[model samples]
Target: MSKTVGVIGGGQLARMMIPAATNLGLTLRVLAEKEGEPAALAVTALGSHLDVEDVLRFAEGVDVVTFDHEHVPQAVLRELVARGVNVQPSPDALQFAQDKLLMRERLAELGVPVPDWARVVSSEQLARFLADHGGRAVLKTARGGYDGKGVRVVRDASDADDWFAAADGEALLVEELVEFRRELAQLVARRPSGELALWPVVESVQRDGVCAEVIAPAPHAAGKVADVAADIATTVAEALGVTGVLAVELFETTDDRLLVNELAMRPHNTGHWSIDGSTTSQFEQHLRAVLDLPLGATGCRDEWSVMVNVLGGPATGAVTDRYDLAFADQPTVKFHFYDKAPRPGRKIGHVTAGGDDLDLTVFSARAAAAFFDN
Candidate 1:
């Protein structure tokens, strides 16, 4: 008998899992937010993720429940757990991914390297933090932030006046500005039985705080740095009881040390290259981990694999319309579109290419992504 996995969000992540689930002989049922969403191709049930009734009803047919995004309400998750639902990365672990403050506190308890940070509840506290941090810091909402949203770089107390006034006593986080040389991401998959698998540490390039491209086996990541990254990911997964994929975003400083930047509990954009670059993609590994199946290998298929995100530009045509031009220019490039419409700066798709030559792989991936620009 085939097992069924229910995903809580109807986004590109869920859409990408459909092919992987089919190969693993598992059925994917997505709880989509609306009709015609990206994951509509799957067995979809429409409802608000926060609605307890809807979510519980959707859970009836699936063997286990997971998430495409970590936006589910904590109360609802606890209710699911109370009712005997098989929710992978149980509410206890998922809380760290949902609330940034909780994540920071827990990582610090585990001896994980993190940037200097403090919680600011009022404008006065914000002023003190800025003064101590060279008059500038990065402020973020403790919850509901992603893709550069709900984030601010402030130099003065007034810079956060809007947040302070509208925060309604909610705490905001302020961290010392990290002057990093580059950003890196480590992706790990863990099963309930303590089995763990790790992918190559990759370099992630961001534009406007959004991931623009990723290069697997990050260039020049020799012994110590890679080991530190993998160790950090392993520590987090084991300590937090994470039962699926955990993406640990890191900051490589000028001093050559790595610091934890963020945590994502589901398939992350940084691992999208694995679809074509690795022997087993993150999507497949996530399913296996959630179902308690043996994890797959995370080896890179080539010396270099580059993934470039295709962001919506000023163009108005469908992404598929550019397939001809992109294929003609780089036939070896692998393109994955999310069935989403064009909108400035939105992630509509991505292009991946792997080969022995790093420069050629990067160029081919970028060229294919650029073809969709207009």
Candidate 2:
């Protein structure tokens, strides 16, 4: 009998995992709220991640349970665990990924470098945080923030009232804006058997608070920098007792120090390039880690590979037509669409291009993205 894997959430990440699970000879089942939610359309089941009965029923006979997102409530996860269902990146480890405040505190306690931050529950607390951090800071909700949502840049104390109102006047986090040279990401995979592997560092470009592009083996990054970042990621994964893929988003300060920005316990946008650019993609590694299978190689298959996100724009109706025209001109580019309805600023798909020359690869990726726009 083949082993079954139960995945929570039904986004592009889950959609991508389907191919990996199939290749591994594992059955993929998803708990989703509705139809057409990326993976739900492709997986073996459709259920609500929040529905205890639905999730419990969905996990029946599955060898292990994993996730595409960390939005599921801990109580629900704990309930599933109580019933003998195996949950990778267990609830204790996932809490840090789910809550920014909890992640910050844990990293601090582990002596990991992170931005100066304060947790604020009221206007008075916000005011004090501003005074201590030079009247400007980034405010984030403790939980449920992603892709530029639930995050804000506040320069005045008055902004606290709006933040509090936005979050229903609940507690929030205020963090100092560090002067950084560039953003970097380190991805690591940890198995239940205590094995781990690290991938090459990648440079991530953010536009309008959304990831725009990723360049693997980040240009001009020193060998030492990559080693340090990987070591830090490994340390954090072990310290937090995380099982499965863990992505550490880093801010390289002007003074050449790396500070943790965010933690993701799933296949991250930063590692998307590995799909066609590495010996083993992050999606495959994630599945292996969750299943406790031996991890594959993490080495890059080429000197340079670039991945560009295809954010939906005004010309929505022309996407299919654009894909036809774009691929006609650039047959080497690999495209993966999410089978999603297009919405402005939504991530509908991504393109990856690889070449011996970094400049050419980036140029090809950018041009392919532009071709889709036209």
Predicted model with the maximum TM-score: 1
CA lDDT for candidate 2: 0.89
lDDT of 2 by residue, 1-374 (tens): 88877888889999999888888887888877788788865566677788889888888988899998999899999999999999998999999999999999999999999999988888888788888988888999999999898888888868868768777856798999788999999999999899999899999999888899999989888587898798889989999999989999999999999999999999999999999999999999998999999999999998898999988733647567776778887799998888877677889889999999998999999888877552
lDDT of 1: 0.93
Candidate 1 vs. truth: CA RMSD?
0.8
CA lDDT of every candidate: 0.93, 0.89
RMSD of each: 0.8, 1.4
Alpha-carbon error at 341 in model 1, in Å? 0.4
In the predicted model 2, the residue pairs found to clash are none
